[model samples]
Target: MPNAVEPPSASPTRLEEAYALLADASGAPWRPLAGGTDLMVQMTGGIGEPPERVLDIWAVNELRGIGVDADAIVIGALTTYTELRRSPVVAEFVPALVEAAATIGAAQIQNRGTLGGNVVNASPAGDTLPVLLALGAEMVLGSAHGERTVHADDFWPSYRTTARRDDELLVRVRIPLALGRQVRFRKIGTRRAQAISKVVMAIAWHSSADDGPWADVRLALGSVAATTVRARTTEAAIEGKRPTRQTADAAVEALTAELEPIDDVRSTADYRRLVAGRVLHRLIRDEGGW
Candidate 1:
């Protein structure tokens, strides 16, 4: 007979209560449970026992809203993908994020999966990660002591690891508004709807006019490196250049050089590299009408 799984020792519904529990050093380390879309899966699938202490923050009102400040759109960590799809602000300023969010899962997963959970899970294949990296988003973490912000580029320093401290909660994400930039997001997976991506990418750029040169190009990719990475070399190569096939090919060369994809069950490193280039080429062609 199989052994029964153990339940979390404590479940706190309020933010303050959760913090106090985390601040207590005498107890076991508490894993903050947001939507449990990812954590629950890990726990059920893993060989070891589930976490002994879980801080359930699903009902914490402080972590569930979307607002706009002077320069950026502030999204509470608990904001669901469904909320993102419905948000006019997200549609207007960060449509790529909306696009990425729509591709996460079916309606049920979209309803329960929070943005914070995705960020904290820190999967290299996470769909929204490339969008966040391209948009230059910032993560806001909070603890009983205080709050500190980390840029998205620096958030994931290694594979499946984030800069978030054990005692800190990912409170929210702030995305700076890039009003007139042309943004694109694409995910190449085995199947369209619910499959993990082979290669996921997001690209954003500014241009003076419809036919002008690309400026301030920002390109980011997931499943191509240890962490979702901004393709700085590729961006630099494409910057100030018109979106032509030659330019796109050159950008791809630079991008291929920068990425270090590995062979996994989902895709081979060569296939990922090839698809990434193809996607970038198509994006450039479509954007330029070439």
Candidate 2:
């Protein structure tokens, strides 16, 4: 391995400056550095050659806070897992996200590992992706020209790949908040802490009241498919029904059919498939009693 040496980089304090630099250096082959939680490891020999230059936007104030509007919550791309776990806004609007964030790595990792890095890295086992997908999040991409929004479901079509343009940066994620909508997130890992998930599941539902029939529901899972994906068949099965053992059982069957699992270092395909169903069933029974 090469000696540990600093790579050439530029640190921009403002979002506009970062965008301008990217635009000015267009096609010059640079990588944007956010938290460096994943990139730093890769630099130490996880994969391909390190980038010749890195654009450091970690201190960009524009990409470091959470904001809310009437209909949605906007989480800046650089927001860390620790920040998410600590935010009262996140606690209220998307508590399940907090649950997911708590399961990623340890204290130091949570402090430096960013939600944007997680999204851009596009790991199939990324803990937050399933929750974001279930919450119907929207990704905002920024370039010198302007900003564009893409649905989270449409963002990742394959493993470790996304619709992000080379010249663009992921600025923030918008998570929708509707009345009476609740979400549940669960990560089934080999162990509770510092373990990569064997299977991860998130479910969101909306109804008229706490005990009302389900008006709509969205379900997503990770580590069981090419990319984090929706359990559309399972969602369709229980959309209008109240949570019941019978309904959950049928939904579990639907979910099993929807998943495409494969053996990996962390877990086996059969285990992931079977556990995914049980997790959904438990989530519905425990949180979806309405």
Candidate 3:
């Protein structure tokens, strides 16, 4: 809000020529910029020490498209939260994405903030992260050389750090055809909407027989660990078991054991663990663990 970075050198075309120049340049330490939804605000608030040489990527047409690919629904890095929330393809293909998109920030923030920024920011409390993790999404990184894909599950190496190399720009998030096996996204914030999540969970899977098993169960949780994590143990416990009361209870137990939540300002470890159990119960018992 305070600082609208006056480009150290003006970009003639604002978007196209900037990337073209940066693309052709050698070892440019330019900060590729976007909608300025997150980055600008951070810089203004003194969270960012100073502005680096800026390379604007926000206005690139190639980085703003969202559609279904051969095997996945691809959301471009520059695609805003509001864009995703209103996208029919995303709604049909990855409904959980819509759910997460709707809760990102206020309308203004959602209008400017992008999916790529969210992924790269790597906040544990990030609303969409758990959903992306559960859906087994992949990120496509682009640069002068080419592109590479990394799975969301294994993307983050530490708190706020990802496998994304510095020079590479995140191009798009790819959600595979296996996404909709069964999906439910849940968030626990101070209020219904517009509040940062205390806990966010996304659980996806397929139910077996009438009361038999649940297979391909994937559970991703946020705001409880250094980074978002998969509830593997809980998922395995109920994957091939009957979806009865007993199995549901055991699933909660497994989930609790798998997490290592720390005390934070919004919630405590005990509270988060308890909420995790309850969320598992609701997801598995009532909604058929999808």
Candidate 4:
């Protein structure tokens, strides 16, 4: 009898070759690794496991960098939380981006965990997501054939997953250059920094064209529904109308209806609903929605 060929072994060399082979062999599934923050935790705790080899792509330099273009800021997939948190551009131009980055676990987690990994992890509590949603960001996906640009709005087709194909890689995130948009980001956590948000909100909008009303509002929320959502009804209620207490109250009502909070260890569904709306109200009122 002919000798049976041995399956791929779980070695570093095998891990390195998996990507090269899978780039052509689409039939096999390959688990890509980086800091392995979430993956390692899941694997160690038996959250899940795979029979195939893992591709350690952390060393790929192409996936790491931060730069700004004429129309947008580009963040490479491998850019870590620490890099983003400490970036001056993040603080000056996208303060919400910095706020969100600062809240992703502790320093160690920030150093290793990457933005791409966070997006791929697909958690409702992912800190950067609400801001990205509000920013109208684009997700750039790549495969052997070429690259495809997907709006962040369209990328999350469902919970804990994105529109990334079986054979594609999430390469980078592109954020549109926003001007004079009074942005505000807030998170309610167990303590303060380095904690998962029970409630999080990011609002990007200008005060008004001529002190008339809220203009170009994009209010995104997290841990509210199945995925982070822009509060359209609330936005419509205030758009083109002078920012006032009455409008704020109406916006809160709209927000309450927009989100369908669920019960979880973090908080009660009812509490999440009330707080989510309140966060919107506060952000608009104090954080410059007008």
Using TM-score, give the best candidate's number.
1
Off by over 4 Å in 4: 1-19, 49-51, 208-212, 288-290
lDDT of each: 0.88, 0.89, 0.80, 0.77
Deviation (Å) of 278 in candidate 2? 0.9
- Backbone clash total for model 3 is 0
Output the lDDT of residue 75, model 4.
91
> Taking the tens digit of each residue's C-alpha lDDT, what string does model 3 give over 159-206?
888997656778899988763277889888888767887789998776
Better of 1 and 2 by TM-score: 1
Give the alpha carbon lDDT tens digit for every residue of 158-182 in model 4.
8777888766777799988867676
Model 3 TM-score (2 dp): 0.89
**Model 2 misplacement above 4 A:** 1-6, 25-27, 288-290
Candidate 2 local lDDT, 74-176, one digit each (tens): 9999999999999999999899999999999999999999999999999889999999999989999998999999999899989799999877899999998
What RMSD does each model have against the real structure? 1.7, 1.8, 3.0, 5.0
Over all chains combined, what TM-score does candidate 4 have? Answer: 0.88
lDDT of 3 at 39: 67
For model 1, residues 1-290, the per-residue Cα lDDT tens digits are 23356566566667777778888888778888888888887777773446768888988889989889999999999999999999998998888989999988778999999999999999999999989888889999998888999999899999899999878899999998766787889999887677788999999888878867998888999998888888899999999999888898998899888878999898899999888988998888888798
- Cand. 1 TM to true fold: 0.95
Question: Comparing candidate 2 with candidate 3, which one achieves the higher lDDT?
Answer: 2
